[model samples]
Target chain A: MATAAARTFALSAPLPLDNGQSLDGVIVAYETYGELAPGKDNAVLVCHALTGDQYVASTQPLTGKPGWWERMIGPDKPIDTNRFHVICANVIGGCMGSTGPASPAPDGKPYAMRFPVITIRDMVRAEVALLDGLGIERLHAVVGGSMGGMQALSLAANFPARAERVLAIATTARHSAQNIAFHEVGRQAVMADPDWQGGDYYGSGHSPDKGLSVARMAAHITYLSETGLTEKFGRNLQDRDAKSFGFDADFQVESYLRYQGSGFTRRFDANSYLYITRAMDYFDIAEEHGGKLADAFAGTPARFCLVSFDSDWLYPTAESRHVVHALNAAGAPVSFVELSAPFGHDSFLLDVPALDRVVKGFLA
Target chain B: MATAAARTFALSAPLPLDNGQSLDGVIVAYETYGELAPGKDNAVLVCHALTGDQYVASTQPLTGKPGWWERMIGPDKPIDTNRFHVICANVIGGCMGSTGPASPAPDGKPYAMRFPVITIRDMVRAEVALLDGLGIERLHAVVGGSMGGMQALSLAANFPARAERVLAIATTARHSAQNIAFHEVGRQAVMADPDWQGGDYYGSGHSPDKGLSVARMAAHITYLSETGLTEKFGRNLQDRDAKSFGFDADFQVESYLRYQGSGFTRRFDANSYLYITRAMDYFDIAEEHGGKLADAFAGTPARFCLVSFDSDWLYPTAESRHVVHALNAAGAPVSFVELSAPFGHDSFLLDVPALDRVVKGFLA
Candidate 1:
C-alpha cells in the first residue's frame, strides 16, 4: 500500500565501476509493495529518472508530496500493486538516502565532489545487488520512463535473464548532444555560485540555492512543448491586471517555473544533481558495446514494449524506433507504439489514459 | 563598404511609449549603406532583432565580428546594398550606441532599472522618427528576421504606408507563451546574480557575467535544432579521450555553448538584456487590437512575404501562418513559405541560400 516506508540494503563488498574503479560501502534505498508470491515471479522493478527517488507509491518524507507516479502505480492502476509486488529503488548518485554525493565518505565527511563518477550501468548493477539481497532471482517486468526507461533497457541488455518483460516509456538508449548541452548549462549554473564552494557547501550557512534554482528553471523548459505552454499560460498575467513594467513573475508560466525550481532545491542535493546528470550524459548503451546497438541485446530473452509521445521532442519517436529496430535485429520480441500527447517529454509523468492502457496491456 | 561606423541621431522631442510614459533625450544609433536614389523609392528599412545593432552591413566595433546580416546585405547579396539604400538602427532599448538602460538619464546618470519599459511598437516608432530625421518619406521594403521580423510587422501595422513591401523571416507576429517563458528565464538568471546589483552593475567590480553566460547558454540551445547539435557535436569529446568522470566540458557542444555564453558577457550589458527582453515579452499585436489579429494590419498597403524555417520550433510555421491568415483577412497581398533549414530559429542569420533567393525575389 502507499503507507510503505523506505528500506535500505548495505553490501559489504565494494561495487566495481565502469571507470576502472570501485565504490565502497554501497547502499541502495528502496521500497516494496504487496507480497513477492511463492515463486518470486510476480516482482516488478520500477526505475526512477534523474531527480526521481524510490518513493514511487509512498509519500516523500521531506516534502510530504505523494509518490511521483501514484496515479499509475496504485492498487487498481496500470501497474496494479494488488496484482503484483512492485520494487522501486533510489538509484546510486541519487539524493534520497542512497549512496550518493551526500553520503558519508570513509572519513565521515560527505563525499561531495570526491564521490566517484558513476555510469548508468553502475546504477543498474547496484539495483541488481539490491534485488539479490532481497532474494529475488527474476523480475516479472522492468518498467521506467525517461531516464528510468534507460535503466530498464540497461537491465535487460546487460543482465538479460533478470527481467522477462521490459517497458521503456519516453526514453532513449543514448544521450543526444542537445541533452548533454542542457545538462552542461545546469552544471555550470550550479558551479558558478560562490556558495557552491567547489561542491563543499555541506556545512555552509547558505547553499547554492539560487544557482541550483536557475539550473532547474533552465532544464524545466525542455520538459514541455511550446503548444503546451501556450495553451496553459498564453501570455497570461499572473495576479496582475497589467505588466509591472519591471522584473517580476508577471506571467503565470514564469511563476509556475519558479515554483518548480524553488521546490526542487528543498528536497534535492545540488551535488547529487551534478552527479546524476553526469551519469545520464555519459549514457550511451551502444558506445560501450562496439558502437553497434543490437549487440547490447544480442542474446536477450526479454520481451520489450517501447512507448513514445508525438510531442516528446526530447526523446522523440525516432529514439524509440531506434531501440525497437535494435530489438528486432537482435531477434527479440518487441512492441513499439507512438502515442499523441501535448505535454511533451513529461507526458509519461502526466495523466494519460493511453499510457495507462499500454502499461496494463504490456504487463498483463 | 564594411568600414562604415555607427552614427547617432539625437531627437529633441520626447518619444511616447505604450506604458503611458515618455522616453526623453532619445538617441537612435543608425548606419546606412549604398546610395539613396533621386526619387527615394529604393530606400529599404532593415530592422535589427534583440541584441542586434546598427552595424548591419558593417563590422561590429565592440567584438570585431562581422555584421550580423552581412550575407544578406552585402553588395552582391539578396538585400543588396548596391541595389537599394539600406538603413539599420539599433532599437531604443538596445545597448550599442543607442539610448537604452545603459544610456544616461536626464540628469546624466545611467538609467539602469529606472529606464522606461519600451515595446515593439515604441521601437518601430523610434525608427520612424529616425526616418523622418533622414527626410525619407517611404521605405521600398522593411525586412527582418526573428525579433527583426516582429519589428517589420509592427512597422507595417502602426505606420501602414511607411513601407511598400514587408519581408518578415523566421518570426512570429507576437511573442508566444513559450517565447516569453524563455526570455523570463534569461531575465531571472541575470537578476539572480549579486554582481548585477539590482541592474546597476555599471561601476560594480564585476558584472553578472556568470548569470548572463548561463542565460546565453539557455537561449543558444533554442536557436539550434536537435539534429543540428547532434550532427555538429554528437557526444564528441572536447580535447579528451573520454569523459573525465567529472563536470568538465566533456562534449564539444558544451565547450561551444560555454564559449557563446562567456563571450556574450564581454560584449553585452546585463541591464539592456532585461529591458529588451521585457519589451519582447510584452509584445502582443492581437491583444492591442480588440483581440483581432487581422485588425492590426487592417488597412496595410505593404506587400508581405512571410518566411519560416521548418526546424525553427521557437517560431514555427504555424506562427507565420497565423500572420498570413491575418493578412488574408485584412485583404493585404501576402506570400507565405516554409523553407527547410537545420539551424532552428537562427536560420535567417546563417548562410541559407534559399533565404537569399526569397529576399531577392521579394525585393525584385
Candidate 2:
C-alpha cells in the first residue's frame, strides 16, 4: 500500500458517496514533511481547512504566499516536523491540485456543476484513501484548527484506530445555524454575479472576480475578532484629512477588507468556494450518530484535546465544551482549555505561544 | 418658527453638513401622533434606525407593511402615543419620503452617486430643524434604539436643553470595529454588483437588487442571535428529507436568509443603503469629543436610561456599560439595565415585555 511521496494518487475504483452517487477517478493531492519512521509509528496527519492546500510548509503555488500554517509546522515549531512525519492534503472539493469542480471528469471536461456534492465526511474519506495508500493505518496524532479541526475530529470518530491522539482547535462538532447562514451569504454573492454563470465559467474570458471578492470580504470579517479590527484600523480614514462624502474606500478598515477581497479572487476559484462551503454547512457529526453526540465517540480510545479562544464567538468555547461534555459522557480521557487571544477564530494560525505549549504538551 | 404639524417641511435655508458642504432645499418628512398640547411641552421625538421611516406608527406605503416600531407605540404601548405627541421622521439619508439619494438634486436629476455622506449627527441636525419649525422649544423625551439610539444620545449630548429625558436601547454610543466591518461587507456587496452602475441606477430601469439583497442577508444575520437561528432552523432542510447534492437552498436557514434578502430588496433603495451605512460607519461620539466618551455628555442635563440585550454581541452589554460610565462621569442621572432576550440586537423592535416595562417606567 506504499505510494510515491508528495505526489497525486488517482484511485480509479468507484467510491460510494453520501448522496447516493459513486465517484470515479478520484485524485488526492498531498505533501509529506520529515520521514515516515520505521513501522510508520511517528507519522502525524495534518488536516487543512476550506481554503488551505497541501503546501503546509512551503509557498502556495497559486499566490506565492507563504503556506497558511507555516508558523505552526516548521522545523522547531510546535508541530515539530523535525521529529515526526507530517502529511497534509488539499480536500477533494478544494481549488488546489485536488480533484474538485475544476478537475477533469472521465469524459475529459471540467466537472464544474457536474461535480458531485461532497460532505465533510467525503473530504475525510478522500484523505483516508491517501492514508490507505501511504500504508499507515495506526499513527501518532491528527491535528487541525477551524475546518481542519472538523477533519481531525472526524478521523477520531469515524476511524477510531487511525490515531492515538486527537487535537482539535477553534472548531465545532457541528456547524451552527449562524455558520450556515454566513456561508449562504457568501454563496449568494457568488451566484448573484452574472459572470458566475451557474458555475460553468471555466476557460471564460474573465472569472467572477467581483463576486468572489464580495464573498471573501464577507467571510473574512467573521475570521477575526471585533477587538482585533478596532486595534488595527478604527475609524481611521484611508488617505484623506477630510471626509470624501462619496462612495470610495474612506475608512481604513474598508480599504483593508477591499484589498483582502481583491487579493483572494486572484488565488481562489468562485465555484470551488460554493462547493466547499456547502460541504461545511452539511457537516453535522451528531446527526451521523443518531442524534447522540456521545455515541459519535463511544468506545473510542484516542485521547482528546480541545482548544477555543476567548473572543471566538464564531465557534465559541461553548461549542468546544459541548464536545468535551460528550467525550466525558463517552468515558474518554480529554483535556480542554480556552485560551485568551484577541484574534478570535484565527488565533490558532497566529502567534499564540500558549497554543504552542498546549500543542507540545498534548502531543507529548 | 411655528410650522404645520404632520407635514413635510421644505427648508430652503442652507444647511451646513458635517462634510464641509451645504445642503439646500432640505425636505424633512415627518408624522406626529397625539397632540402637542399647549406650550408644546408634551412633544416627544422618536428617531428611526437604518431602514426605518417616518411611518413609525402608521402604515408603510412602499411594502404595505405596518409601522416598524408599532410594538413600542400605540395607545398603551411603551412610548404611549395616547399621552404624548410622538414625532418620527425619515432621516435625511433615508429613502422613504425623505429627501435622500433617491430624491431629485438641484440639477433636476436623482442625486444617486452625487449624494453627500451624512453622519448620525447630521440626521439629528435635520430632525432638530424639524423640531424648530414645529415651535417645539423642548421635548419631553428623545427615544431610540440601534442607529436611532445613536441619534438619541447625539441629541442629548449636542443640545443639552432640547430634551428633558433620553433613552437609548440596544445600541452603542459609537460603532464598534465589528459593526463597521459588517457595514463594510454590505457596502462592498452593493458596490461589487455591476448593476450598481457606480450608484447611478435611478433611471436605468433596473437597480442593484441582487447586490442589495446580499447586503441585507449579511446584515440580517447580525440582527438575530445565533441561538435563535439554531432553534428556528438548525440544519432543517427546505421541503426535502435528503440532501439535494446541488447548490439550491437546501437548508431552511438558507431559504430563510434568501427570503429575508429578497424581501428587503423590494422595499429598500440601494443608493440609500450605501449612504446610510456610510453614516453609521462614521459614528463615534467619543472621537467627536476628543477621545473621552464622558466629555461628549459633560454638560448634558437630561436624565438618561441605557438598555442593552444580554445576547446582543453585535452591540453587547459591554458597549452599553461604556456609555453608562460616560453618563455617570458626566453627572447625568442615569438608569441602566441589561435585559435577557433571545433575539439579539433586534430585541428592541420585538415584543420583549421587560423592555416595554423598562421604557414605560423610565418615561413615567
**What 10-residue stretch in candidate 1 chain A is worst by lDDT?**
A1-10
The candidate scoring highest on TM-score is 1
Query: Model 2, range B194-294, lDDT digits (tens) per residue?
Result: 88998889888888999999999999999999998998888899999877988889999999999999999988899899999989888889988888999
DockQ values for all predictions? 0.80, 0.77
Candidate 1 regions exceeding 4 Å error are B1-3
Instruction: In angstroms, give how far residue A279 of model 1 lies from its true place.
Output: 0.6
Docking model 2 quality class: medium
Please write out the lDDT profile of model 2 over residues A103-180, one tens digit for every residue.
Answer: 988889899889998888888888888888888987699999989999988888898989999999999999999999
True contacts kept of 1: 0.80
TM-score of chain B of each: 0.98, 0.97
lDDT of each residue in B154-273, candidate 1, tens digit only: 999989989999999988877888888788778878887789888888776779998899889988898999998988889899999877887788889999999999999988888888
iRMSD value for model 2: 1.1
| Among all candidates shown, the one with the greatest DockQ | 1
lDDT of 1 by residue, A1-364 (tens): 4557569999768999988999999999999877778988899999998988999988889989889999888788899888889999999999898899889999999999999999999999999998899888999999999999999999998999999999999999999999998899889888887889999999877788888888898888889988898899988899999888777888899899899889999999999899889999999999988999999999998999999999888899999999999999999999999999999899999988999999999999
